[model samples]
Target: MKPHRYEEFRDLHRAGAPLLLPNAWDHASAAALATAGFRAVGTTSLGVAAAAGLPDGTGATRAETVRLARGLSRLDALVSVDIEGGFSECPEEVAALAAELADAGIVGVNIEDGRPDGTLRDLSHQCEILRAVRESVAGGLFVNARTDTYWLPGAGQAPETGERLDAYRRAGADGVFVPGLRDLRIISELTSGLTDTPLNTLHAPEGPSVPELAEAGVRRVSCGSLLFRAALGAAVAAARSLSVSADIPSYAETQALAGAFA
Candidate 1:
């Protein structure tokens, strides 16, 4: 039986504590993390769509997203999907997608408020969708309301981030996510108005450490596509360096890697 992991994760957030959510691109990544002892795993939309050769947040990979979620459900961790903008502009449509995710054994979903079309979806519209989604899942899924205020190019992102989170909390979101905001001072400021709702931050390379983010009152930290991207970069760099240098990967190193595939 699939574990009712959502309730446990939800309760973790409710305790004014931190939950470090590692984003997995596919089954192997998720299963490895689960075996390594993660209680929960989040799917990075960037990692997901990029693997499928579709643009993230474009509604082009809905089928791929569902397939991946289905596969990850076999793991032991609570799975939370990043369903960018819920794949539709309509509230009912978003809610329907949430229902499908729930039926797939997804314990939670993260839906953003900004669209790829370069404008913020009206907070009211986002709230309507959130409410609809909350109502649809009778078993209570964790709805993480993500704000692209910082990720999107803009000068007014900070203020917009705070406003969006405030609205999301009032709309009954279990958590709020700001993907690109990493400063401790700014994070503290932004999370002040959101009472009871956990603040979720994306893990940045130059951002505050996990302990620091926890101290800053962030309840969740997600490594969104960083590991996958880093792996790709490392592979390409290894090939390039080996071509120019004598210190290439040894016979045993190459054999060990090849043996795994074999």
Candidate 2:
């Protein structure tokens, strides 16, 4: 009953070393990331939702998320799906979805408790979702329980962060993700509070670097919508530059950048 992919992903969260998870939006993006030597790739919910003309965190891109997961799972990398709020409030439904993703070759899933209406779900309910998903996957999938206490304005204070993360770990969460947190002191405090679960934080260009986060006890750094947004910005800037400067990137350089995905 050894879950090879699950153990591999779990091992990526090595205490203070931290794994760098660059999220992908589509097949090409994912393939490119894998080609770039990233061992694991996660899907950004915003990238998938916005690309489909739907608002994020509103359960609007369930089908697109699943389709993307199915495709990305085939890549030569461990795939994790960012299933915002589990795409349902019901624990049973969320568990079912997790099972489906596991069957589709997804080794991990990030489930958040923040609602689209600018509110976080009750702690008890979120724990229920985590527990159900853990049971459904049965160690075959890594359930990264995500708490938006710091992301949602007026949600709660720092102490609440530890409480929620501790509760999530007790409810069978393999890892805990707290995005929108950048302070190194606070990151260290939260990470120190967790004994069994690994701490995951969002990556910010203006904030602490990956090395700094690892020093602060973070076990995983997720580049959540950053890569997707950067890719979009790069596309627009490249197009604009072509109109202004005749010195565009050489075809060989572009092909090299595309690597095997090309």
Model 2 / residue 197 / CA error / Å: 1.0
Q: Residue 154, candidate 2: how far off, in angstroms?
A: 1.7
**How far out, in Å, is residue 225 in model 1?**
1.1
lDDT of 1 by residue, 1-262 (tens): 1236667878767334588888889877776667668888889899999999989877788888888888877776788998888989888988998888888778999999877777778889899999999888855588999988888777258777788898888887889999888788988887677878899988988888988888788988889889789867877887887643375456665544322322
On residues 1-262, what C-alpha lDDT tens digit does candidate 2 reach at each position?
Answer: 2289999999999976899999998887787788779999999999999888999999999999998888877788899999999899999999999999999889999999899998989999999999998888898999999999889889885888889999999999999999999989998898888976899999999989999999989999999999989878877987887553365445674565444432
Window of ten residues with lowest summed lDDT in model 1: 253-262
**Candidate 1 segments whose C-alpha is farther than 4 A from its true place:** 1-3, 14-17, 241-262
TM-score of 2: 0.92
Work out how many backbone clashes candidate 1 has: 0
Cα RMSDs, all models: 4.4, 3.0
Per-model C-alpha lDDT, please? 0.81, 0.89
Clashing pairs in 2: none
Highest TM-score model number: 2
